[model samples]
Target: MDRIDGGGTMSLHFGVFEVYGPQVGGTLSWPHPLSDSIDFADSQHWVDIAQIMDRTGYDFLFFADGFGYPILGDDIALGAVERGINFSGYDPAGLVPILMRETTGLGFVITANTGVDHPVQLARRFSTLDAISNGRFGWNVVTGSSQNAVAELFGHTEMVPHDVRYAIAAEYVELAKKYWEESWSDDALVADPVRGIYADRTGITRVTYDGEHYRSDGYFGAPPTRQRTPVIFQAGTSPAGRAFAATHAECVFVQATVPAHTARNVAHIREVAAEQGREDPRIMSGLTVVVAETSQEAHRLAAEFDAMQTDDVVATLYAGNTGIDLLALDPERTLHQVLEAGGPVGQMGTSNIERFLGSNGAPAPTVREIIDDLKGKGTRGFRIVGDPHKVADGIEALAAETGLDGFLIEPVFGTRDIAAFGELVLPILRERGRLADRVDGETLRERMRR
Candidate 1:
């Protein structure tokens, strides 16, 4: 059971889907008068945002990794730049420490593309954050999806096979786990001033692991963190991705536009975990809430958000994510047919079309269909635009339908949007005994698992 709050019980948790660099996609294609006021580039802005989440009693804050700007027909896609798609931003590794210092109870989850990052270096960086957060750190483990990221990071032009990439990721995680868990004993650190000792030297020992993709020999340079190994989080829902999550991840990101279908996915993963003799991982879906006192006003806000996603912004973002540039493809080729056969598959084949097929369990969507879907979109996920009651109903419905543990809110207006949810929907959830209203002293892992 989760920790009970002052007058309510914790039935669900909430986190932000993304709190990325200042350059994150926004009111680029259209007039985003309010968003212009937000300075994503300023480190203080994030600190302020972290404080907001902390005050709101949010479970965690997460940031995404970007290789570079989006690429379409040109080496550097100018259209994307004008549309304000992908661009360079602050490093999460760097940002997490800053946020850790600024806020408490708000866990920080940052991405580490296991396909490209060295296990030892990853362990050190994550361990440092975990220590700083006092074990309030979690990792969003990803196999690189962007081809640009792959080429620049690994010096590889052609992509690796999808399953093989996961296999590599599998080992990458294993080796990192070795370092975080086996390197230092709980009593290794002996900061005894009178004894003239800072550590029990004998308690520290080297941990060696040799896998198909990585090998390491040495004790983890960092001390044992709050969570011995930070809680593992994964995002891919492909077969290989699902398998890996079942075996290792404590939490997963599911693309669940269809709640009934997502229920099946959740059940399947839990079954897999049971088979592995591990507890089920918490399942969190992305949520967007546009709430106002009046339903009409909420709808207006939704429309305003919808206007900003231009054609270039939509295509570039989709292409960057799935490695399938619908604009670059032969218009005559049916996207569904090609995707089924691994059409122009990248390293991990984590394309939108593949995810669409798996989540929908319907015919592969056509190229025209995908374009139609992306036109003038503000954001993705299951968005609820209505008065406070309706918004709360939608959240409860989705959780009941899919057995979801929580949602990661992705807002267009950043902190203001999150504030609206905290103000409008949170009270209702609290009234219904579904929200955690405070963070006392539970570890991040404890909070998520409960």
Candidate 2:
């Protein structure tokens, strides 16, 4: 099958996978002197980044968010706050309209939990956002990973099982889709001042759902936006997650450590999507790029960034991600030994461990080594440390090797690295025919599909 476009060029889409928090992806990035993390709380900070990407030819700026903080308890939570380790940020949903107004062509993807939000409210909110962005909007659907924290916040006593959360999300999305795609016909809205009728009421229908996990019955308030259902994105790599993405997500994010592994995942999702009658699920792997005018300088910058990852910060963020306490465990013990001894782990933690094992070819890594990997290139996709040419070459090679649709660039020093990438690598890619020309006023869905 031909992967290239009709022009026979490698037109790869690019987006930044962001968190609205102190750090984007790398933990404890706020304290770095070169980082623009100081203004994370300011709306202008986000606006600046969006404008930069918009001018640089990025397809979208994705905001990965959640309502629950990873840490619990006062003392540990205080420590997390003092270190600024993914502990602070505004809701990306609220920031969408503000950003869309500021940028011309850059798309905005906001992460929203299907398990927690009511289907009706979620549908309406996305519809409004899509309209406000003039179709430059997407939703990153997640099934509430921070189960304990999320459950506590929502006043639920029992934690929803991992697979069960996927089930709930499936139903939740189905109901929301009905609201987005079925509630209103193409000609529902009509500004007929002559007949004193604003909308053809006969063309509108009530949307209702009574599933095992959710219930919603309502006349959808918002009319259909440019893209009636905003582009759906999912970022889970587990079996249940892959199934969910295959079934619904228009774009998928994977954080494999190697190209071969990423290729396997991409192929699997495409196959599943094909079986489900949804062809060509767009898959993007997480990538962290560090580039400078010289290879030596880029390596020096990468090393400096690595040096800032303190043990406490690494452990704090790692524990938050996998539910495994690196500090409490014996550093010398192999990961194999820890898991074999029945280590305490949740669904996310187990998945991370398994990915680590698969990448290393064995679980012989010490707990400390594993911790270091997590702080470095563990889950973050193929790291490129070089000049602009080297970065572009690596990206092109990886795309050819893995059959990935695109990449979600992970920031090393927040906006500093993102800006650096824009200034250095983007031009090289544009010249190499790896990026498509930006079409102004195109909807997010159109840009993604193109």
Candidate 3:
């Protein structure tokens, strides 16, 4: 394959568990027993998975989170729950500590929104976790996109406007940085044995900052962790989102209906990041992988998986995400007007909605077209089905064309999908010299830089 760097050499960074926890069960909605049966409740299982991923040289296992169920017709979130969707799983954060203890070098990236917790609390929690994990921690910063969550849990009457939420997130991350980076100096942790002191108090500095959304007036309580501040990950494609990510994110997750669209967004983020003083921000796109011994078998498996995704589940998910109930709109009605009108809720403002609805004045895609697009045949980040070599080729192609740093491999099944990737695709990447060799207990930052 041709390389973007023109050196006939390339590196492929792979991450897993972007939505629900891979495509093992053939849906992203509720009643996700397929994923649950993999033993999220078992601490040993989490550790084994972490160890396996690290040994295979997988970059990280990212947990995609949501605060509340979808806001469709019923309060039940039936479409998601009944179908074993993405929302059926438990919060991955609760499992991170165990996983951290299980593996030596694997990075743990968790999604925590600025809307849910205060900066002081967030700073303390991440700092403690970083220390516990010995610097193998990253945060996927988000200003929540669930209107139902804001109203029900946070006591907000409505979700904040898109731009305004980004504004808040900017300040939120700034506060976290101040706590993580500015509060403690390298000399702070003396750990002098004869002196019977663990830390030199004088080396710790207090940070005082006044901002529109948040303010702080204290030194970080915990001592410095491996990386003072965990690496920041952001996922949003709005103009404001891009600007915010450009200023703060080290890694950005992107999703688009097609490869061209993914490439366009990658370019946009790079430009914005450069403008904000970051020369490059690692871009990771969402992808699904299905692999078998032969190309034909892969196709047959993919077809069976596609057949399992009922229209009700897909439509319900689409409606909840866009805030325009597809059930209310005529199935045959063009989504043009809805796109023009936007959503009733502020948090539902996503750039992908237009692409899904064909609001950019392109030919509107049918529900099947949308689903097929999600399957990744014509789409950018989604990887529908392929044998080991085919899957590797698709990943390499995407990175070369879009200048992306890597991909977040959303699984098609439970642990088996991830296990299959480790067994099949990883070896191909390794033979091609596109994958990293096992490192000896490196920090997350060092690993990322490598």
Candidate 4:
């Protein structure tokens, strides 16, 4: 609560990864001891939580998205239905206006797949939000991981190749950027009642973009906002995805592997940005923590929650992703060969490949390894379990170890999870000078960009 002015060893950014609607993933279908009793179905629930986060000095509240439920075994929706998996709640963009109206400081970052959106519409939507929110909006660009969702949900019978999807994302983002950055001159809007004209029509210009994936030319329809382009956030870990982020992203979300792995990722991203004549993007790692009054209590809480990874859960989610049933793979074959024999290279999933799921250069994992990884929060990101002090120590050490920008907490409960963290660990962080000084009127972009 006290000011640190121009001093602090380092100021780590903070954010929470939670749903705008009902919950999904490991956050749902599990017992929540610290969960808030707020009604998730009601709009007020989101607004109140947003306000709480803003008051606590969070940088942003991020919502990840997917079009469909995770597929387990044969039935695509059964496992999700039985496990109470809610893929999406409210539309993040639509709900942004509501949250913005209620809270003054928190930034909102929403994920949108490049494979599905029209460049122009996506551009206008974000540009409009930025202007209206006073530059408090951000866009998290993703080349969707699920082939089935893209095909079935979006009505595309043929799934786009993973690498090719990145190519398309490149064009999609380029076109969107042109609209956000170049389509209209800053002085284009002139409201002059004295001349009896809201003129400056001469300054307005059109954007024309043509690429292998898309073509568009039009006068931009969105008015300029605080940040002409809302802060560009990207969360791709693949080589192509990393290259794309280096070229365009302002905030890069990376899965937390080991400290060395994350440190390497941060260095590579900065190097890529430098090559593109840009500074290093603020790099954030996903973190899921289980903490209570004591280290023993925290571990007990974590152990109490069942993983709920039945065969049905694994098969449904895996099949929906790569369209290859793990149960069907030959037991004697190595995973590398099994995948090759399963189907085309492009169709084999790129998201859960060896680098992300298993350790580096380690031979492909056995089917047992696959199940273990998918069960609960396996190899997902940075995970810590302990009391407030221990949790704070882990976070501080990791940030110091990896030179990370900050972390997006994968909320373990409802709003209470975040509230508890703010009350518990935030003071320790403040005392240690890890969090940035709270600026009264800092714009979201200014807060993160610095």
Q: Give the candidate number with the greatest TM-score.
A: 2
Question: Per-residue CA lDDT of candidate 1, range 270-346, in tens?
Answer: 88998999987888877877788889998998888776656666677776666566776655455665556665654
C-alpha lDDT values of all predictions: 0.73, 0.81, 0.70, 0.73
TM-score for each of the candidates: 0.91, 0.94, 0.90, 0.90
Q: Please provide, for model 2 over 324-359, each residue's C-alpha lDDT reduced to its tens digit, 9 standing for 90 to 100.
A: 667777888866665676754545544676665535
Q: Give the Cα error of residue 187 in candidate 3, in Å.
A: 0.4
For model 2, give the RMSD to the true fold. Answer: 2.2
State in Å the error of residue 345, model 2.
Answer: 3.1
After the best TM-score superposition of candidate 4, give how far the Cα of residue 15 lies from its true spot, in angstroms: 1.0
lDDT ranking, high to low: 2, 1, 4, 3
In every candidate, how many clashes are there? 1, 0, 20, 6
Root mean square deviation (Cα) for candidate 3 = 3.5
Report the C-alpha displacement of residue 37, candidate 2, in angstroms: 1.6
lDDT of 3 at 127: 88
The deviation in Å at residue 440 for candidate 1 is 1.5
Provide the lowest-lDDT 10-residue window in model 2.
70-79
- Which residue segments of model 1 deviate by more than 4 Å? 1-10, 23-31, 36-38, 152-154, 329-333, 337-342, 346-351, 355-362, 376-379
Candidate 3 Cα errors over 4 Å, as ranges: 1-8, 18-38, 339-346, 357-361, 366-380
